[model samples]
Target: IVHGAKRVPQDAVSDQCPEPDGFFADAEQCDKYYQCSDGHITEKLCPDGMVFNDYSTEYEKCDLPFNIDCSARSKLQSPQPSEHCPRKHGYFAHETHNVCDKFYFCVDGKYNMITCPDGLVYNENAGICSWPDEAKRNGCSSEEVFQFQCPKVDEAVAATHPRYADPEDCQYFYVCINGDTPRRNGCKLGQVFDDQSKKCDWARNVPECADWYKGRLTDVQLAELENPPTPRPRATKVSKRKHQRPRAGDDILV
Candidate 1:
């Protein structure tokens, strides 16, 4: 337990007697630590994500762990290790307790996963794990079954694609390899967009419309008919102001 005068780094109890209980600066800032009478401070650096819990008698650095095994626990009722947890959802309990030095946990699960996030691997030095984007999860892959193959696509195609394939064909339909829905769509100023698929019921969007015109059809064309705009109601006076002349009864004989 930490108490009285602070302990010195390297665990040399302060011969000077009692030290402060909480955060105190050090002659050497290699790392500021809570000193115990024992004076032993940790050599490993506390990582960015970690936090130190200061007890009246001691200070301890804690972090989550990696490399979890879900079945490691002996039974459901056994006391859990601080390293591992048994959350109810979102994650599985590695054990009643945790074993790793630094790892993430969730209220739902003892461990977010036995491993870690899908992309990031772990780095012992940095005390974190990361992965290369465009690794397995990134770049083009054959896993997806598009209606048509992208010969060589650019931004417009990316934005428009089979639904929008550049200015020339963004509104037109094409066939994707998967044969789900035809990769065809178009936007019009009004409803009943086109006779292409009898899909011309109405335009769902107006990318080039004015503020007032937006969400409204420009004209009353058959395929694009919209309800006429209603004017705002004007205010009406409930009563006229008092007459400037004296009251009729008072002025009768004046």
Candidate 2:
């Protein structure tokens, strides 16, 4: 909630209370604001990684940079950094060059490490997990991480987003966007990706992937997952509706 404060004397009042019992923002700093009560102005600052929301004088609010525009008042408070937290709040990428999936989420100088979903990497620019191709990190590109290249295909097939089976892992496959950009994907447990049909099916249905889960899962385990017994439905009770008398404030429906 970023707004331009009128250069008018009423809104731009700084260093002194413009009116009694109200809040005011500092003209030059996004994080600095003032609280005025009984004609006394007291300086205040928003927490690190947040900007002052100066949309209202009756209430004071601080919000994240994503929700506030600070082009006019870009100045912020001094950073209160801590271990793994650069400014007391925000998402940060892992320090390791090759560790693309892990990152840190910091709040108030404390850190919580997070891992991206499979086949995705942490995108520092957007502060969220995204595709490796989109993350654009030098050592974290899809090819560098997956070690697989998209096979050359005609424009017709490329435009359809072709799916290819992983050569090393029968349960996994690669989705080639425009026949160039590759993204890794996988079949569900107890199933394998079928290149011919471009879908997941029971391992026994795909000869090439019949032994895909051989060492990882026993035959009995795979059988149970493929053909698990269904559970009985639970009994439910339906309550009967009762007539109610009209109340003074209740609206009667015809």
Candidate 3:
């Protein structure tokens, strides 16, 4: 102002600077402007999902406390947690749940459970396969029905009963019993449970392995085997019968 003729006088006043708004524009730019020694930088801010904190400032980089909830997430997302057979493959290993707290078992060989009608049972308490008594009262089985899966195992077992292909092992059973409970008894593959004794008794007239099939052998199969047909060897000592008859004949004079 002293050197130039048009300049203002030495006593002129200057405009004041504006106060800062709360925003930092960018934490990177702020950090370049201000820094203090003491391991603390005066300016910087972390973005959302994060906290602008002292630990970040000390470390000279933002440290994100991970928002992860390790406990809330489970490793067992595959089968979902279950009460019975907790292991999960592509197929469920056990019944999930159904009537009451009891597990609703899937019918065998399918590796899944029968989805019972919601309010009722999951399996037949009658112990028959899909032979529902109430369903029978409605005449479910009385109608003309073919023998279910009869030929498959019987044909397969003819080769070698147990050694090659047994009917029971082929993921199915052969029950000769049909329709309602019989007055005599009924036969199931590899079993015959007596309702009277509540035991696995035998079916009458059915030929089974190891014995004659006079039918269900409800008593007990004798474990002691009969001896082989070979005859006993010669007698070892004098016979009492040999001594008896000779007394009257040889001692007749006396």
Candidate 4:
């Protein structure tokens, strides 16, 4: 819907007006189409980053390439490149291979850089943020990002999705999916990962992690966080309206 008339590339396709009033797609180009009205023909181009959806001749619709199949008419207009945008529109990966979490979303040859959530990488193929293992981008695998490997276990234990303590940080842990792929996770503030119990618990209860917050928090601060004050209950308001009895001749309200 965001179209720039000045940016649309000019292309001529010598075609007859098939219908009196309708839109028709060009045979060779996915972004080129024709508008016919009263036996008159006009060549049209979709926005730079989109393709003409030729599912029907009744309506003119332009959509993103991800949502439309353009195999037969895969040819696209020449890109109007800009800073960080190879094309006028679409999701693009970071120029640096090692920088996996950031990407660029381009519109009208303008760029908006975006960063994936913690422990996630931008999936160029799917155009969204996803787990490093799932994204499968070279140099950005789960092993490379997390630097943790799932311990070898029997099939039975592997199926249970076991948790393991992070060797470097007591407040963080890793969950092995199918006992192979390691996913980084963290315990909430004031808590530490308990390897024996395989869950987050008070720092004081976990022997190895008892002094995990030694320099970070004081004794009183840890106690206050571990034992937070309970929330007060709200007072209920009683209705003051009295119910009235209907008389014999009164119309009943169903």
Best by lDDT: 4
lDDT over C-alpha atoms for residue 84 of model 3: 41
Q: Against the true structure, what is each candidate's TM-score?
A: 0.23, 0.72, 0.15, 0.75
Model 3, 1-254: lDDT tens per residue?
A: 00101322223311111112221122322111223333222333332112222333233332222322223321211222333423221222124222221232322222344443322222222322343323242222312121232233454443432221123222122233332221122234434443333334334422343233335342343221122246779889866664445554575657
Alpha-carbon shift of residue 33 in model 1 (angstroms): 11
| lDDT of predicted model 1 | 0.33
Whose TM-score is greatest here?
A: 4
**Residue pairs in clash, model 4:** none
Tell how far residue 52 is off in model 2, in angstroms: 3.2
Off by over 4 Å in 3: 1-121, 124-148, 152-166, 169-173, 176-208, 211-254
Q: How does residue 98 of candidate 2 score in lDDT?
A: 88
Q: Can you tell me which runs of candidate 4 are displaced by over 4 Å?
A: 2-28, 36-41, 53-61, 233-254
Give one clash count per candidate, in the order shown: 38, 0, 8, 0
Q: Candidate 2: which pairs clash?
A: none
Count of backbone collisions within predicted model 4 = 0
- Backbone clash tally for model 2? 0
lDDT tens digits by residue: candidate 1, 133-244: 1122222122221224444455554454333232233233343223222233444434423334423334433332123234343445523345546778998968777667
